[model samples]
Target chain A: MNIHIIGGGAVGLFFAAQWCEKHAVTLWTRTEQQAEMISRGGIRVLENHMENIYPVNSKKIESLYVEGDLVVVAVKQYHMKEVLPLLQNAAAQSVLFLQNGMSHLDFLEQVPHPHLYAASVEHGLAKIDGRTIQVNGRNKTNIGSLRSGTAGIIDQLQTGSFRFDWNENSYHMLIEKMAANAIINPLTALLKVKNGEIAENARFRAIAKDLSREFASVFSYKTAEDTFQSVLSICTKTADNESSMLKDMKAGNLTEIDAIVGVLLKTAEKNHRSVPAFQLLYNMIKGKENTPEFMSK
Target chain B: MNIHIIGGGAVGLFFAAQWCEKHAVTLWTRTEQQAEMISRGGIRVLENHMENIYPVNSKKIESLYVEGDLVVVAVKQYHMKEVLPLLQNAAAQSVLFLQNGMSHLDFLEQVPHPHLYAASVEHGLAKIDGRTIQVNGRNKTNIGSLRSGTAGIIDQLQTGSFRFDWNENSYHMLIEKMAANAIINPLTALLKVKNGEIAENARFRAIAKDLSREFASVFSYKTAEDTFQSVLSICTKTADNESSMLKDMKAGNLTEIDAIVGVLLKTAEKNHRSVPAFQLLYNMIKGKENTPEFMSK
Candidate 1:
């Protein structure tokens, strides 16, 4: 498969490095500096358990050709608007959004693709440096059709060392992931705590539960007690790994709070459900997201 | 008039040191250390424009007889419950609450006294060290009756050093202060920004405005525009001064968010009004408030 990755962050690099071993993989980075670094040093995969440097083709977003078997969009949620324009020109057979939040659907609508896959990365991969990924926690990745279902993309993706399943009920999975992000991401970011710290604190646990119940109601998904427990488990597993939102906070970068929490809040408003805790957290994180110091560029 | 000051932080000392020049005064501190420091060095009055220190007898709360005409409670909101017992034992005719937030009303029903005055201070004063106050702003003080019925207490407090107004509609004043604190205190604490920084940022301004609107809906306080602007102005005036909440955050002391944001949220829920911004802010701050580093032994 001629695979193209549309973001050079940890997730994009993780897939590109793994897939390039068997396929022709092209990685898209936002900046020329990042592309240059990857061109010279290749992609470095720093697993939590082991250290290995893998070489992969890296190119700027503008340099990529429009034809590819698969396209992976792994950029931050806020960048989707700009990225969508690029994807509109891409002649990819399948496009998968392996990013945080729900607003990606809006961007996906703008692109000309029949097969759209929306998935969440359960694996914990963080960008340590340019094109360097630190894989922590035994992470599972799930992908499924958003609209006009794609079948072979999962098999094509599985050709690499990536583990993914064809999720028939991916909407529920996406909603659950959004709920977890709504409760966990902004909480950890604002509190300046790790995911495990949130798990450790009963008050935070209660907050997560409150937020989860609200999400379950608005999205019409079963936000079971086990879902919340799973969230805490993720926090425990990724104890030292700063959540994406927390990493954004530390870097003073824009967070995916709007897509994650804002989407949940908007959904709640539409459903006539009150999500006080989620709304509050979304606004707080949004404040950080909107700050110039936190902006991507 | 004899005035007894309790919880000898900046407000208590500000009142005791100034009022003692004209009236017989006793400043009651919680700790023996503060009592000893004040008893030996006296209470210092550091105005934004002027500077002076006055010696007043500082006693522990247990030793306070409260035989004065007016008693001022200047401790933290969390300390209110602990100090309520002491107030019940006091013999004061009038009790004045000079702390931030609306939690003083918690003591409203417990008051055996005839005159109860609630007040808020904008004078940016912080005890940088023992017996030292850095007054960054020459802000006015507001005093009013919780009920429309108490005028005598307001009359007595009018004799204090700063500007004082007898507000028959003090509920709005309390709400205004609460709203302002909800926005300013947490933003300053979380962003590690000074007051002026909040005003400069569009994001913080949005947060302030959103929170104010939510607070107004719940509390029914009306202003021409967002009342949080007034808070930002106050921060600008006290630009170099650390906000009380920021100071608490720095010292790892408990914040009065429960008294400020939490109480407002509860009131909103009771009134069937939604306060999404405040709820998230309350949860975020509440989580921080729960940290062991925040609570004093």
Candidate 2:
């Protein structure tokens, strides 16, 4: 199967390197320099203290013809709107979205593709350079169709190092990941602590509980205790990992606060439920993003 | 007038230095070393970029006879419970309670003194050393009786460098100050930023607005905007000052989170109002306080 990944970020490069091992894969990067570097040097993958470079086709996003069996949209959610139109005109047989947060659910509904898949990538990936990617942790990627059954491209992509699971309910999978991001991302960013610190610190644990209750209310979870435990477990599992939001803050880059927490706040307002914790976290992340240092970048 | 100031911390030492100028004053500190230092070298006051050392009498808290005309309780709210029994047995005609939160209101009601006054110290003060204090800013100290008219000690305290205002409604003044502390203290401590950063930063300002609204709801303020403006002004006025709570966090000491935000949360619960912001901030501050580093200290 011919696969085209629509982002050159860590997620995009990681998947392209894995899928290119067994299938025809091409990476589309926004910058010509990154595309030229990857095309000449190949995509580098560092896992378990070992480095392997995979030869794959690379092209600038603007020059892409978008004719492939599967096109995976792996860009940040904040960049989704600008990239959506390009995907709409693509002649791909199926499109897969691997973005975080539920904000993209609205955009998914409007897609004209016959076979549309939304995925939650749980794998930990970091971009070492323009063409090199580091695999911090290998985890399963949850994928489900928005309007149809599992796409045939999944079987081709789910070979070797690329692992994919078919989620029965795409919304449920997306919401679950969204809930975790909503709680973990902004908090880890705001506290300037690792993911595990939220659960390790008692006071921060209490906050995690309160935030879980608020999420339970908006998501209609059966009990807040269950939600809190799920969040705590995630914190323990990713204890040492600095959250993507925190990394964004440190890099002086804009975070996906609007897509994650902003969506929840709007839902809370519509439900006439008060979620002050989410409100504060959202404002703080937004404030940090708006600071002079971040704005200049 | 003979004034007895309890607690040899910054506020205690500050008032001791100011009151000793016109009135016979005695400072009671928990340690004999601090007391001996003050007794030997006198209390130094740095105001207006000038230093003045005033000769003052100092005694250890254990040796306190409590036989002064006016007993000024200038300790932290956390220390109030342990020292309250001593103040109850004191031979002072009247007692003045200067505390940060509304939690001390209950303790003030239990005092046997005929004239009971609770004053909010608005002045910015920092302890240079055990025997020296620097006045960051001189603001009016609002003093009023919890149940009666203006206490006679107000007249004595109103003179000299110590400015005091007769607050007709002590509860009102206390609530106003508590609201500001509720917003400023935990945020500054948790963010590890100065007081002015709260107002200068847009994101933190949004948080200040939300916190102010929650406080206004519990305290029955006319509007959240007015309360938010008042809190912002306090941030501006003391821009360079590190809040006592923030200072406590930096020093790895326990803060008065319970006295300040704890009271507001309890009040909100009693009123059947939700305050997630305060609950989170309280938990964060309490969590930082309960850390191993802070606990060992």
Candidate 3:
């Protein structure tokens, strides 16, 4: 099966390096410079203390023909709108989306596709340069069908190191991941600490619990205790990894606050639930986004 | 009038420098080394683009006899407990407590004195060293009696630059300042920004307004809008200054989180009101306090 990944970020390169070994995969990047760099040097992926270069096909988004068996949307949630039109026009049999937060659910519902799948990427991937990405940690990708069964492309994409688990309900899985992200990402960014600090630090743990309780109250999927434990477990699992939001803040780049915390806050407002902690976290991240350094960029 | 200032922090040194010009003042500090340095070199105060050396007597806490017309406790709120016994056994006619937050109000009630007053220091003061302090900004100190009238020492302590105003209700004044500190200090420290950012940034302003509303609901002394405006004005007045809590975090010292946010959160809990924002802020500050670097210190 042929696969087309829409994004040149860490996640995009991560999946391309894995799937290129088994299936024909093409990576689409926004800038021609990034596309040229990846096409010339190949995708250098650092995994398990070993460096491997994969000869993956790379193309600029403007000059790409997205005809493939599966089209994977791997960009940050903020850039999803810009790539929506292209994804809609793609001649792909199945569409797989790998974005954080539940805000994209509404947009994904509007896209017309015969087969649609949503995924939660549990791995920690960092972009070292234009074409080089370091795999800090590896975890299973939970993918489930949104509209129809994802049987056609799921098996073809799963590899030994890049594991993929089939989730029965994609919405529930995505919501669970969103709950974890909503609690972990902003707090880590605001506190300027690693993921494990949230669990290790008693004060941060209390906050994580309170935020989880607020989230569980809004979603009604799991109990507050369950949500809190899940978040704590994730923090423990990725203790050494710096959260994506923290990385973005350190790099002076825009974060996924809108997609992650913004969506949860909007839902809480709609449900008449007060989430003061989440609101404050959201505002703080937004404040950082509007800082002079970030504004100039 | 003889004035004995307890605590050689920025506030202690600031008041000692001003009062020493008119009254016989002695400053007491925990460390004998610091006391010796201050006794030998005097207290160097930098204010209004000029440096002034005030001849002030200094003594270690152990050798100090708290006999004076007025005893001003200007230590951090956390250290107030350790000095409470000294203040209670003091031979002073009047006692003035210049610590931050309402947590000290209960402790102040236990100390017996002819004139018991609580003053909110509005100036921005930073301790440059053991014997030197820079006055970042000048503002009036609002002094009010917690018990009887403060007649003997109020006028003697008021200076041209360090002005003092008598407030009818010292409890109200302290609560007002506590509300502002509860909102400003933790937010600035967690966001890693200056005081002005709280008022200047739109998102931070919203969070500030929300937190102010929460505080107003618990206190009921002022309306939400009034509390928000008061905090906004303070942020504007001290725009370039880093909050004391922020300074403590940077210096890897313990913050007065218990005195400021802790008092508010306890009040909220007792009244059965949820203060998620304040709780989150409290936890984040505590998290920083628990860091290995701060723990070692």
| Candidate 3 lDDT tens digits, A1-297 | 899999999899999999998999999999989999999999999988999999988999974455788899999998988888888888878888999997777797667778888999999888999999998889989999988865545677788878999988888999999999999998887777789989998878999999989999899989999999999999999998888887888787889998999998898899999888898888888888735353222
Candidate 1: pairs in clash: A252-A294, A280-B280, A281-B280
Which candidate wins on DockQ? 3
- Model 2, B30-81: lDDT tens digits are 9999999999999999988999998999988874556778889998999998
- The Cα local distance difference test for each model comes to 0.75, 0.84, 0.87
lDDT top scorer: 3
Top candidate by TM-score:
3
Write down the TM-score for model 1. 0.84
TM-score per candidate, chains pooled: 0.84, 0.90, 0.96
TM-score of 3: 0.96
Once superposed on the true structure, which residue ranges of model 3 sit more than 4 Å away at CA? A290-297, B151-153, B290-297
Residue B185 error, candidate 1, Å: 3.6
Clashes of 2: 0
Q: Per-residue lDDT of B164-208 in model 3, one digit per residue for the tens?
A: 888887888999999999999988877767899899999899999
Q: Is candidate 2 or candidate 3 better by lDDT?
A: 3
10 residues in a row with least lDDT, candidate 1 chain A: A288-297
TM-score of chain B of each: 0.90, 0.95, 0.95
Worst 10 residues of 3 chain B by lDDT: B288-297
lDDT per residue as tens, model 2, A165-279: 8888888888888888998998887666789999998878888899999998988854688778978988888787878898788777889998889999998999998888989
